[model samples]
Target: MFWNGSTQATIQMSTTTPLLWAAFRGAVGDQLPVILALISAGADANAVTRAGDSNALMLAVQSGSEVLVRALVEHGAEVDRAADEVTPLMLAARIGAARIVGSLLELGAAPAVRIGKYTAAEYAWHGGHDQLAELLEVCAGAPSRYDQSS
Candidate 1:
């Protein structure tokens, strides 16, 4: 989704399950233990909110918690899946989360994939994360120093 000139994302009504909500809160709050407990209780890591705007993995990336990201992915979160047209890889790259980006790549996230006209490399570049942009470009098979800002 395109930004609406707001620093905050548009909040949407949520009909998400309690387990899902708890997991999401855990991710967002950096409460990994709670998330792990929920996971053990059969929480679906891929379950999204009613608006389909987010999931545990997305929240974890937004929180910049690599451990939470890894745990969620290991519990079956799809790294390349888009929420609000943004992939976890793109989010991580945009935030300059190098470790999380590396983890997502190891989890089989496709560096060449895009949401609309935006690639992860392009997101990184637009966010002023040059190193992440270069890394994503190289992973996508583009030459080093490839300009993704176009």
Candidate 2:
């Protein structure tokens, strides 16, 4: 343990878990080789960070890495899992990651799932991804405003 002068508190330094390191790398860079190695060495793909705010797949979705996202899902990450009230599909749509959203859909992410009052399609529309929003709406089997106009 060490004194954190900035926070005015004592902070215990611990070795970073493979999952946490992979999540951080997923968010900032596409370190696929390293992540795959860690996974092969027994890292749990579904493991969340200490704060319970992130996992490798969530960060991969946020980083817009479709391959990384798919790899994590195939390796046992829950595609529809939510962290801090936000699902991976919700994050993908909010960030306008069409391909990542598609991958998540193929991996069984529920298009109709919602955080509070909004679904993934709503997030896509709010993010200015009209075509993606329409796609998600169709997948969810919900009639979209775009359909009403046609």
**Model 2 poorest 10 in a row by lDDT:** 6-15
All models, RMSD in angstroms: 5.7, 4.5
Question: lDDT score of model 2?
Answer: 0.80
Total clashing pairs for each candidate: 0, 0
lDDT of candidate 1 over 38-115, digit per residue (tens): 888888888787777777788778777788888888888887889899999998899898999999999899999978
Angstrom error at residue 135, model 2: 0.6
lDDT of residue 46 for candidate 2:
83
lDDT of every predicted structure (CA atoms): 0.79, 0.80
What candidate 2 gets wrong by more than 4 Å, as runs, is 1-16, 27-30
lDDT of 1 at 59: 77
- Against the correct fold, how does model 2 do in TM-score? 0.82
